[model samples]
Target: MTLSSSAERPSRCADAGKLEVSFEFFPPKSPESEVALWTSISRLLPLCPSFVSVTYGAGGTTRERTHQTVARLVRETDVPPAAHLTCVSATREEIDDVARAYWAEGVRHIVALRGDPPAGIGTHYEPHPGGYAYAADLVAGLKKVADFEISVAAYPEGHPENGSVDTDIEVLKRKVDAGATRAITQFFFDNDIYERYVERVRRAGINVPVVPGIAPVHSFKAIAGFAEKAGASVPSWLAQRFEGLENDAATRQLVAAAVAAEQVLDLVDRGVTDFHFYTMNRADLVYAACHMLGLRPKTDEAA
Candidate 1:
């Protein structure tokens, strides 16, 4: 199926109403952060995302915390939680144990990844001798444990470690072959990059949904640092938007909302429906963007 550059908007079903959306949050590092995260979750829950995900830290550093957070969500909230499992620091047995525990706790979705190294994103990744070799391997292993709904990462620009676009697509295909049900891309600034990448993936014969991951820009410096390590390009135009708003929190928030809303709306206009928001454990900006996209609470009648 050849996708035209102009065919970027997601197809909508009149009977199904607006498009479905999801969110991603990381495990909190402190009590104050925990409070902040729950507050954010509460604010966005009314929008009724398809599911919410919590990120696992590098080298399994946040394994326990991630499990706790995901389990709590299953126990306390109406939202279905997707727990991220990575093949970085643990052996196959250990990784499987985490997946089993999540299943026991009623978590049916898993976001599998070849996580970052202990030293962080820029450092080279070296797989443990007895661990799952890559995310594809981990996905296969998880399938043996349970009939889990799996999602893997996709790179729009390209992965830092991959040789070329073909290699990247091949890796994605392998993940799907290993039982991944969907792919969520790394956060990107330009929608054109995402459109082209998705075209290539479909051309490669991978038929799963490749959901776009949208990161709401909260702090310019913080996001820039992340882009540097994650290999996501920060367009000059984006830099100009935040150029002089360092100390201007009020103005920066306004600009951030506008910039992110423009990106998602462009994606919507292009025919892309499903969005996975990297909420950064904050609600105001992401919530505002979702509202602009026509998302609303699921009232009792609708439910």
Candidate 2:
């Protein structure tokens, strides 16, 4: 039977077969957006994700807001929060202080990266005169501050700045050696690309969970624009899927859920279970996708 709307679908309870998920959110820029961010958090928290992360802005632009948001998550939420740290514009002393503060605040996990240059994407990234030069250096430094569980960025398709896949894997190996426990990938639509990258990573003897990053296509045009700048490929097939639907918000949501569900299920069938969603601070599409994956709000029995 055809469903009248997305809400018509019935909710299921958590399943016996386990599939762990995490979500990523960016710190809000305004009071109103802060309200929206928490609403999204409350909506998705019930899924009992492994952990949620708040993103740091380019060049530490949102350092204070990021700290505030992450501190609040530690203080108020049952789910663990991972703070993102970047080495783009800060000195080692400042970065170390941030790490120490997080540890003091009971924040133990961090997504460390060599953040984009302050000038913006595509511009050259210059390390601060006294800061860590790369993510591996930052990871090592964090380890010195505390035994924090660190996660670094990975790319299925090699990073834009890297000259080759081998170079990218070498960089990743350095981070893992430096104390990274996990690597969350840049989102990609093709499972083959991810699988290949994982194979390469494994062959290099860097053993860690490189979790797939999944972005539910909220706005195809917007995501396409981002993918373009971020050096991610937007498949021609994906474009066809969203063709001519830019004006249709309601139908677009439905299509977005379907596409994301299909992507995750296909990955599940291939023996992948853990996933990290770049939630973009919107919950409907992600919640719907999790529902289809047989995840549910924790009930007394499930909890």
Candidate 3:
């Protein structure tokens, strides 16, 4: 559950297919946060992720900001940008129009999702009338608009609303059938959970790369809160690692780094070559984790 900070960092992954990484960031809410987001983007850019995704706010709240950020990514950066498109509060035409705009702006990848309702109602989710009813439906609609590479979400631990993790896998199968090219799992701490989920995925005949999602703990308490709503479990041991470190930022950071590095390294040891990082719009811990994974800056011929 914990790794010493002094453990050796790998220089590279030698296994077949090697290692591939991608990052996720939410659109900024303010000018200061926007600056922080770009700062993070700069820090991770040199690691050369396959693509970086910008998240859409629930009910499409950050729709314009997501579009603007993605357009900038297309124009300003060398990396491919994947804009999140959700079937939240928009009509089919509206969503399609946004897709077309992204295509015109040189954005070729999309993260399609069936986002929570805009109104933030309780657990009962009813697809908005006249909108795509589910993520599978959304994926199909995105395909019709353009032949963009699509990445859909998978829940290794069942989604809070889903009664069974197996049911979530079935939905993932339909998404792949509808043209999703990849799947990024919900962030998970337990490798066993992810390994078993992948096993089930293969048994269901879904062969797409189901990348494990890694979330570096910026704040354990906050993350624990999110896990509760996300239907993901936070082990008691994790809390023990953070206990009494609330006021100690430096020590807490080291502990957080240790925990996340251990998680990813274990996955690497398990032969998982694909990874998706939920950056939470910050980069320090993520950068460190990638470094341990043998990802180096562009100037580093050592990578």
Candidate 4:
């Protein structure tokens, strides 16, 4: 699919009700990046995503920036902010303080995660000495701090450390048992992988909504690197879709939008309603995909 528009793809079902979407953003490290982050947020907010989440960096490195971004969204925009809290290197008390602070700021949703190790991807994860040990523990701790509508990470491709798909579902079950209300999966290119994971989660009796994570391919090379580290398999077909577009930014964006539209439309046909987009702090591809899904910019009155 070289430089095609989503209009070439099948139209969304007439009866497919408006798809619910949430976008993920990482905290910016500098003033210029912060401006870019908000610019992306401003563009996507008008689409009225179900919520927007700010990610915590490995070992809580971006904790403050993530908090500031979420707080600003709560105060300055109509988009619901779901702060990402991780149990990586902080004590239980420290983590609790952050959760309490978010509640104080009128932020109610949280995407709780067992963040990557301090040494970064592929390193062994060691829980903080006195902190919530895992995401399940973090969900329970956040509930103790406040009745947060907690969202936990679900690995459709078993977590690199966990080493098995069955075990991944078991871990997710523990999280749901520990008060997580939803599970947003790590991004996957194969819809069958996601479908099978959801089926297994249901068979295991973990009943919370498992929202599919949809990553619109902003940059094929960038996404491939992320997928490798994050344990998501990038199918050959997916790779072939972006072949030869490395130096072509404009064509890349168009192909990205079309590929993402096809993915979401396939999911919608499969009865999936909610989608969580890993926006990578850029708006165009994700915005275009959502527009293709029949989601429109929120009018002033709606806001």
- If both were scored by lDDT, which would come out higher, candidate 3 or candidate 4? 3
TM-score attained by model 4:
0.93
The TM-scores, one per candidate, come to 0.93, 0.93, 0.93, 0.93
Q: Per-residue lDDT tens digits of candidate 3, residues 1-303?
A: 886443243423344227788999999999999999999999999988999999998889999999999999999988999999999888898999999999999999999999986654655677888989999999999999999999999999987896488899999999999999999999889889999999999999999999999999999989998899788999888999999999999999999999988998888777787789999999999999988887778855654
lDDT of 1 by residue, 61-138 (tens): 999999999999999988899999999989999999999999999999999999988864557888888999899999
User: Candidate 4 residues 1-303, lDDT tens each?
Assistant: 678765454444433345688999999999999999999998998887889999999899898999999899989987789999999989999999999999999999999998888763458888889998999999999999999999998889899776589999988999999999999999999999999999999999989999999998888998899998888999999889889998998888888888998888888867788999999899988888888788888788975
* RMSD in Å for model 1: 4.5
TM-score of 3: 0.93
CA deviation > 4 Å runs, candidate 3: 1-17, 119-123, 300-303
Please estimate how well model 1 matches the true structure, expressed as its whole-model Cα lDDT.
0.90
RMSD to the hidden true structure, all candidates: 4.5, 4.7, 3.6, 3.8
Worst 10 residues of 3 by lDDT: 7-16
Error of 3 at 107 (Å): 0.9
